[model samples]
Target: MRYLLPLLFLVALFAMLMLRGYVHNEILADHRIRPDASTDTVPERILDGGPVIDARGTGKPTSLDIPKHKLVLTFDDGPDPTWTPKVLDQLKKYHAHGVFFVTGANAARYPDLIKRMVDEGHEVGLHTFNHPDLSYQSHARIDWELAQNQLALEGAAGIRTSLFRPPYSSFADAIDDKNWPVIKYVGSRGYITALDSTDSEDWQRPGIKTIVKNATPKHGKGAIVLMHDSGGDRSQTVAALDTFLPELQGKGYTFVNLTEALNAPSAHTPVTGMDLWKGKAFVFAVQVSEHTTDVLVGGLAVIGVLVFARFGLMLILSFLHARKVRARGFRWGPEVIEPVSVIVPAYNERECIANTVRSLMASDHPIEVLVVDDGSTDGTADIVEAMWLPNVRVIRQPNGGKPSALNNGIRHARYDIVVMMDGDTVFEPSTVRELVQPFGDPKVGAVAGNAKVGNRDSLIGAWQHIEYVMGFNLDRRMYDVLGCMPTIPGAVGAFRRTALERVGGISEDTLAEDTDVTMAMHRDGWRVVYAENARAWTEAPESVQQLWSQRYRWSYGTMQAIWKHRRAVFERGPSGRFGRVGLPLVSLFMVLAPLLAPLIDVFLLYGLVFGPTQKTVVAWLGVLVIQLVCAAYAFRLDRERLTHLVSLPLQQVLYRQLMYVVLLQSWITALTGGRLRWQKLRRTGAVEAPGGIPTQRGSKENIDRRPVA
Candidate 1:
């Protein structure tokens, strides 16, 4: 049942294609002829014998069987603006009138022609809404087609007709067992099913003489001549009529409308107030559906163009970033051997507190680990104090969120450079040294560390790991080259103490304190650089629900930061560069791209159902190939395993959709001024610090090193 909705959507899209003339059934395809100048065509059959009635006659008369030289002229499949007007003029020239079998689609498009047909004393009848061969359709669909056309006829011409001529019908002889049910249904509805006696075959566009010869009836016999005023070029039919009608009149035959020729009541059917109201409503709905289908197609086209542009731009920028990285050799300026203050913000993170502090203590650079315990009920402070390590301080405070804890920790720091990390993250021994070296340039305000997922054995974790490398790290490289790096991950980032003080320390206005501070630093005229080698491994969510919550906060917080610094776009110098180049790119790839990603699925299904299968598959595979190439490049840059490519397609189908929904909900929450509380994820203790030290309950003996600031 969960799959039913997508199946229904695909079916509806296919029906729309049929309605919009993109897909046609065999009957329609067979009848559809292009109006080309070349006159070569198939010869039409000549009816020299008497008119043939249904093999199993339903007691419906084939013709008037008139004693006088009289005939009924009929046209089908029209109300065409071009050929229809010409046909009507020819009838008017000879003071003649004919019955016109009009399809609802064409009638709705050119109602003025239907009105002219009525005002000029010609007759109107029903052709199915899209000219489908009703023999193959279900009963409900056939009824719907007929009802919709009735409604359209009333709306367009202010009246309903009881005359209906099924498509693909040439004469009475053509109605057989296959079409018997449909004819019976129409008869039950009180409609007169008109059939032709003489086959004009003008639809074939044979020479004018052939059309006239085929349509001319036997001597002393009255007949109904068949022809079309729509579907294709009808000039041959119209020209044939100009010659045939006059010569027939000269031979003492009169052409009259269906009612007069049949000696039957007028084709206009009486209606009730209820029917009239219902008809008007149905007509309005059909119009809206047509317009909406067009809008959907146009929207899909726009989304395709945007997706292509995004892929192209990401490839080009990432390539340039790679070239720049290789040219500079991933080396920072001369190393700054300054003591760094590492602030580990914790809230209910007692499980990983000791491991985080131990990793910091083992850093090659001189550093003090400040584990700010933000009111953890699990004795997180006691666990840090039990370590008995040098230059490690455990500050206990009320639960004030991560930003508040970081601000408190930074205030008591005794170093010029600060490294901020999460309690669940463990850094490499050289992480601090590599992170702080960028400060050797006085203009550099902060350095963003490369974040890796440490618990990537699970499928969900693997997806997040790929995203960190292909999405986050690759984006940072592009951002670094453009000087528009917007985020410094809290997992591992280093900042100059003066730069933090200048930006008023960590901001509590957003959930993403790191991103908020980074944007603030950018606006304050400082360079935020990416330190690719400063790797920190952090535990990622292992379940879909947990991943959703974590990403929701991240997406929501990023939006807040972007909005907060929107004015930077219009500023001068570095701020303006970030606002114009960096901000737009982030917003495009982060927010807008995911928002429009659903179109890929929609178009994929549409193409599969209504378009060529091979082309659709090729196009889809082409997109996936491009993404695979990009992901391969990113993996190589991050020096990670390429086996993660096995999960890329599955990630697109599942993880990518989850991310899009998260971002969409975030947008909705931000737009509605809704407040979201920080959600603490369930810690699995799956990640291990360097030397395989699990921070669960035991593993204290792994922390043997003692270093000082």
Candidate 2:
């Protein structure tokens, strides 16, 4: 393959890459890249995610825990001299509270209306300085619009909005690597989207009841109903709030500020911690707007055309395997009976080895446990050998890390199908069964198990759990549906014996052997599947220190893998799938994501810091409010999602920064061409399991005559 030759020579080229410099600090000096590392407040400021609001005090304030329904009457695009005063009257008439998102321009024109918003118990927020096509504006222009309007809102009313709504709710005008960082800037502006749970369209001159019906929620909790008090002739909106406020209040709904109800602890009791909102908008955009299908297909087209195979034979294998899959009718039997070689590379894993070995034993599939005792000073080999497990076997050797140990085990492995799992992870009994099910088709080369967080109650674990579920799970499904599952995860992977042997077994050049094997499988013409239901419970780094170390290794390992496999960069087989599709994916993830992140981040900051023209910081805040809403929405989505996706904004501020650090460290190491030897994480916490049943082998005569894909 064209990719393989360059890859084998990659480590040798490390000196040249290093001479190029590890850190792209030029961007930092130019002020475009902020590492999110230093605490120094340079000219750079990350997007706070919403309008800088006077959230004087906010944290997990007591939420309104009562059974009563809590609703928010949110009016957007207002502070209108023509209609807002009248709307305030109706709100007062019912003695109810509401939130008014005022346009910065309108607020400048009508200061008293702005004052009335506060004086009448209505919270004032920004709708934008002039409500332009938010998407079309550059980050600089977005900031300018926000700043200009922020000044108007603050000047007119003594209030400084801690929340904002973009004029048109256009998420991002551009979808480029350059605009991703700006997502953080805009998000810091506010809490959620134009809380348009209700749509009055009062500007359209709808009838009074029609407007009211359009603006009111159908009586539910956590409903932040949207109505228009401005933006156009909003007399209908003014009257609608009047009509529905009393009726809804009569039905036991109490209205509160956007910062309240959801944060409040009791019915009618406000959520007091103002600082609770931390919106992070993780934006992903490109220069020109494109449809989703076009974007996805573009990747395949670009990659397929860009790469050629390094080895002709491997390319042929892929062609044959993919062809075989398309022609197969693999059936699902009542039980999966594939004999699997369970490869466990243990080093000082005495505590975890038995448990790890025992878990594999519990799986319903036929498994022969092979614990390769990589030089454990703690007598891990003795422990495993002592177990004398009926299904277990131990091979002790000098400590050579995981890949070396796995290599030793692979040579001695007894079965054609092998399952490799981390010693520290636990699995459901059905895990092995599910992992092997995809191989019912002979064409299937490998499968990655869904890794869920076992310690989710911990803050970091909860955060990562959300990430694994939403990110890994969703992307896997999306890729699987697309027939291109990249990056078979290291935590748990299943592979075919023939495929691994053909590729010379797991190479030790890359730290991420899992990723290496996955690429090899693709080159060899086997499908990589993500079995979401096949779950593995693993521990996440509980502290930042552990998080950093773990990520550093993963990142460096990936770089090494990329270097090792550079030969596959642009090679295609007669079928052209591996060269065209698979190799390109490697470049997208390995080369592109890190390269583009810094440029995009600083480009957004140029708008927020230098050009937003914030004679008053309030000007930039209104746009930030929108960011907060988007983040809140992201959070809610993660909460309800099966993959347990975390709030994109939160990850932007926290996890994304981690990526930057890892990238920098890995790049430096690559340049220096250093052998990595980082401290290993010692497992302290684990979920104790109940006893599980070990697998029993069946007679060879029972093997089915059905063809493997």
Candidate 3:
């Protein structure tokens, strides 16, 4: 339900955009108006067919019935900067005036234009705000549109326009049964509705000659000529006026404003304080929305660029790391042969604790396994003690959490090198040896082991396996190359005891204690490296609920860790490298990328409905192809079965949304100052006992190793 609110809010925002014409209007047919048409184009004769508007009403008289050679020019949808000035100049050249019917939005934008219309002996009239077909709108909406337009006009030019024009209506003849009610309402409001007698269709961008011909009356008598100075490229309208105005003057036809042509006094009212404030508020809202839109679009563009840049860099660097690994092979420290202490922090992980211990006991390196039980009521400690392995020991602790338990384990460690493994995970026989080998470099303080998803026979597990192989592992290789490995998975990692002591052991400050500890190591000037061959199989959640809970902890804990070390970005040397390089990469790829990824689906659906179907399909397929190639490469490098690639599309459809939601929840929790507890997953114990199967693709001598599942 928490996720539902944000998703719905986003959908509603897009709907608002659609209504405002930012998104497609096909879904709301009434909001979609033809560019060149408004209610004002409706014939007046149709209104006369009913008792909609009395021809002898108090409304100002129209100029449809006029003397010979008298012309009335009316331009709708004006205050446009580009063509309005040109139109005004042409009219001024011939000493002519025309009625400018302006939409409220445009009127507010160019108040000087409205003032110029009145200043130069031209008439100003209301054309509503946003130019909707008032006949199709509700009564309240119609009222709001008219009232808002009146306020805008009064504020812009200190005049309330009584001469009104309903959008989509043209000549008095265009007023029809469909628009008669709206016309009647405006007439009731004491607004004289002006309609055209002739329309030039100048908005279609027809040649100037055609526009001139269309505007010229056949009998050279009285006519209100309809044209537009906005809503499109009105160059033809301006050009036609340049040539036609002089031609009309040569023919002894005098051009006049609507009021003079009709021989009626101006019905415009004075501006009021209330109208000014309302107009100001509306203008302020428009400005804020516009600026907000600019910022949002700019931010999205930045995020998109960062995401793709990280992908490109990681792909190249990961490829190089793989090549180097293949060519030179892994090297171990001679000192790594010393005995190591392995810590298993258990908390109600009884189902997989035995397997975890057995796997560690089978390690090729001399090691002692310390199982620090963090107040488990499920006999998790009993299970470990039942193993009775000589090198394995169990310790009890209060319910303090994983960090406290790990700290307890470190205190009991009797070796220089310490290995940490979750009680729910199993490792290969040589995993411990492989994990600590990177410490061969004295400066190397920590090793991040390759953690894989066990129990992958299920579809959910399969998706997780793919993520582990393609996303996390590939990222680790990239981080390793950049000398800024940010996390050492608690499922399997090795640390020098001295290095751990120097950083004050694991702190409970973050839920991701491993990440917190590793970052501290980096800031303390110790190099953190990745051990690709040190593979550990950990059980993944079998259900969506469990997955959500587990990820929420991981993500929230990671955020806490990042926040705690955020200042390292400005520090010197290694700390600065981790902060600048590692932190940003983690933030971009892990956090921001996932948050923005949902937009791809949103836009995909939008394109499916309102965009060119072929182009949308091609674009969507192009993205999928890139993902497929990346996944394939990651699988090849990790030596995993390529068959799992089949789930990639389905995972995108289902699993991706869940992960996005998890990240969002984590961020929300972090921002709201809400705390999240360590939520343990129910271990299914799907991993088998150590058997004679070599690591996925290694030697047969150490044949008793298997993949996570």
How far off is residue 527 in model 2, in Å? Answer: 2.4
Q: What are the runs in model 3 whose C-alpha is more than 4 Å off?
A: 1-18, 21-24, 30-63, 66-73, 77-201, 204-223, 235-296, 329-335, 692-709
TM-score of each: 0.78, 0.48, 0.78
* True-vs-predicted CA distance for residue 632, candidate 3, Å: 1.4
Best-fitting candidate, scored by lDDT: 3
Angstrom error of the Cα, residue 182, model 3: value is: 10
lDDT of each: 0.77, 0.58, 0.78
- Model 2 C-alpha lDDT per residue in residues 1-709, reported as the tens digit of each score: 3124334443333332221111111111122222223323311222222212121233321112212376667777776667778888888887888877776545554566766767666776666665554545577867766665555554554335556655543212212233332333565543333334445667788788987776565636446566777667776677677678887878778887766664632211122222111100000111011133244345434433332221122234433433443556734323448588878777776656666666665777777777777777888777655554565777777777888888887887888888887767776788878888887777777888877677776767767776566445544554564455667776677888887887788877777778777777777777777665577777677887887778778778777776666666566651246546655555564455543343223323333444444532352243334334433433342244433333444554456556655666667667866677745777753643335544334534222211111
Poorly placed runs, candidate 2 (over 4 Å): 1-336, 386-388, 574-576, 598-648, 690-709
Tell me which of candidates 2 and 3 scores higher on lDDT: 3
lDDT of 1 by residue, 444-555 (tens): 9999999999999889988998899988898888788778888999998988899999999999989877888999898888999988889999988888888888998999
For model 1, which pairs clash? none
Once fitted onto the true fold, the runs of candidate 1 whose alpha carbons sit more than 4 angstroms away are 1-124, 136-141, 151-160, 196-296, 328-331, 692-709
